[model samples]
Target: MARPVISCERHSLRGLLAVALALLLVCAVSAGVSAGQAGAQGLTPQQLAGQRVIYSYRGLTPPQSLLDDIRAGRAAGVIFFGENISSPEQIAGVVAQLRQAQAESPISRPLLLMTDQEGGLVRRLPGAPVPSAKQVGQSPDPVAAAFDAGLGAGRNLRGVGMNVNLAPVLDVFDTPGNFIDRTQRSFSDNPFAVAALGSAFITAQQGTGVAATAKHFPGLGTAPAGQNTDTGPVTLPADLSRLRSVDELPYPAAVFVGVKLVMLSWAIYPALDADRPAGLSPMIVDRELRGRNGFRGVTITDALEAESLNAFGTTGQRAVAAAAAGMDLILCSARDTGQGESATTALADAYAGGQLDPAAFDQAVARVDALRAGLR
Candidate 1:
C-alpha cells in the first residue's frame, strides 16, 4: 500500500522523542561505567604494593627501567643524590623528565622528587641554602636564622621542581663527632633548642610548598661514634624515660609544625624495641611514631638496603618487613635500579599471599595517597 505523508508537527514530535530516548540510553551507560569504576576504586594488589615505594637510579638521566616502573604505577617517587646532579639547571631538566613520565602514567599523581638538602655538607644540590643547621643553631637568633634558612632551602628545592626536602635533621647533636654532628647535620645538643629551631625550619619549608622530613627518628645522635647504621648496625642504649625525654623530644615539636614525613632510623633503639631496628620495628613505627606522637602524616623508612637490615633479609624482604611494620613509604636508595622493582614485587607478593594485614596495608596506602594528593 502507498505510504501516507505524515504531518510536519507529528514528524518533529517523533524526532524529539527519539532524541530523548537516545539521551536516556546514554545516561544509563555512563552511570554504569561510573559505577564500575567506583567499585574498582580500591587499589589493586600491585598498586597497593607499588604506591609505598620511592626508588633510585644510577645516573643523572631517568633510566628506562624507572620510567617503565612509573608508567606501570610501580613507583611512588625518586630520590636524587649528589651524583645524580651536576648543576641546578641539569637537575631541573632531570626532574622535568621524571615528572613527564609520571604524568603519562595511568595513575597521574605528582611524583615526589626529593633530596637531602639539609644544607651544609649534607646538601645534595650545590650552592648554599644559606647557613647550615649548625651555623643557624649557633647564630645570635637561632630560630629566625633557621626560618630564613628553611625558606632559602625551600626556594632552591622548588626551583629544581623537587617537592620534598629530606632535611632539618631534628636529632639533637648528642654524640659529638658522631655521624650527624661531624657532618653538621644536627641543630644543637639541647632538646629545647632543637625543638624551637627545628619547628621553625619545618614551618618555613612547608610554607614554601616543599614538605620537610624529620630524619633519623627517635634520635640517632645518641648512637656510638663511627657506628653508622648505613655501614653497620648500632644500638642506642637509652632507657625508655630518656627516650621519651631526649630522643623523641624534637619529633613532637616537628609534628606540631606539621612536618609531612618522618624518616625512621635503621639503628636499633633498645629502649623502644630491642629486637628490631626502628625502621622495621612496629613498636617504633606504628605505636610510637603513629600512636604515641599522633603524627598523621607519612612515615618513611631509612634506606631499605642499609647495613643495619643486613641480618634481617634481602632488599625485597626488608621492604616487605618495613611495610608490615607500619611504615608508609619504603625507600630503596641503593645503587641498583632493580632493587626498586624487587621491592615492589615483594610487597605485592606479601599482600597477595595473605602475609600482610589488609587493613594495615589499606591504611598505609591511604596515607601515601593523601601525601601525594597534597602535592602541586
Candidate 2:
C-alpha cells in the first residue's frame, strides 16, 4: 500500500499543495509517526526489538538460523559482504530465498537487503559505479559523473534483488593522504563540491528505486593518518567550528535531496560529546544530524562489532547502547547471526525493563516500517 500524501497547505491549496506535502512527508518521516505506525501497534517486545536488528552471516549460503529468524519476523534485514556473495546469479538465488522467508513474515514489507556498493574498490559486487568517489568528484563534470555512478549503482543493486546501497560517502576530507582521502572514499576537500556531488549521486541512485545511505556522519573527515574506527578506538578532537563548517557542511544538502538513511560514525568527537562515540551520542544523532540538519530519515550505526567498541561490552550491550542513543538499526556486521540474535534479545530486554522509552522505540520501529514499506 502507498503512503497517503495529504496536503499540509493551510491557505492556498492549489499552489502550495506539492511543496507542503513534500515538507510534511520529510517532517513526518523524521518524527517517525506517519509512515506505518499501525503495523507496529501490537508487536511483541521481542518482535518490536527484532525489527531494529540488521543481521549478517559468513560464506555464500545463509544459515538456517537466520532464515528461521526472518520467517518468525524476528529479523529486520540482512547486510551482504563480498564473502556472502560469489556471483550475481548466486546472490540473486540467495535473495529469492530470503524474499520467500520475508513473505512468511508478519511484517508485510520487504526485507532490507543491503551491501557496501560504493563506487570503485569499495564495491562488493562486480559492476557499475566502477569509478571511485575521488574519480567522480575530479571528473570534468563532477555532477554528471556522480549521477551516472549513482544511477549505475542503483540499477546494479536493484537487479540483484537488493534494496539498499550503503554508499555515496559524503565525508569531506581536509588533508591529503588522510584516511578518507587515501582510500578514495571522499569526493573533494571542498564541502560545497562534496555536497553537490553527494546530492546528485543521492538523487540518481534513489531514482532507480534503491535506497542510498549517506554515511559516517556528522563526518569522518577529521580522522587523521592511520586512524580507522573499524580497527580500534579513534577519537577526533576536531574544533567545533571546523566540524560544522568543513566536515558537516554537506549534510544539509544531502537531507534536502531526501537521502533515505544516514550512517553515523563510530569515532568519538569530543567537540560533539566528550564521552561516547558519535553513533552512541544523542547529542550528535539527535542534535547535530537530525535537529540541526533537519534529516527526518532513519539513522543507522556503522557496525556493532567494530574493535573500537571493545570497551563498550558485548554485542548485546553495544546494541542497547546504540539504540538508547537513538540509532534505529542495530547493524550486526560480524558475519555471525548469533551476534544479531544477541542484539535482538538485548533490545527486547531494554524495552521491557524501561531502559528504552516505549514511545521512542515505537517511533523507531515505525520509521523502519515506513522505510521497508517504501522499498516494496
**Could you estimate the TM-score for every candidate?**
0.88, 0.91
Error of 2 at 233 (Å): 0.8
Off by over 4 Å in 2: 1-38
TM-score, candidate 1, is: 0.88
4: Cα error in model 2, Å: 28
Model 2 residue 319 CA deviation in Å: 0.7
Q: How accurate locally is residue 68 in candidate 2, as Cα lDDT from 0 to 100?
A: 96
The global Cα lDDT (0 to 1) of model 1 is 0.78
Could you give candidate 1's per-residue lDDT for residues 1-376 as a string of tens digits? Answer: 1111212222233432332233223211111000011111555778768888998988778789888888777788999998899899999998988888888876757888898888878888876575678888777656656767787788889988999999889887878778887788887777767776677677677777898899888888788888899899899877898788877887776776578899999989887798999988988987888778877788898888888888998998998889889888899999567998899999999999989997777777777777777776
Clashing pairs in 2: 30-296
* C-alpha lDDT values of all predictions: 0.78, 0.84
Best candidate according to TM-score: 2
Error of 2 at 99 (Å): 0.4
Worst 10 residues of 2 by lDDT: 1-10
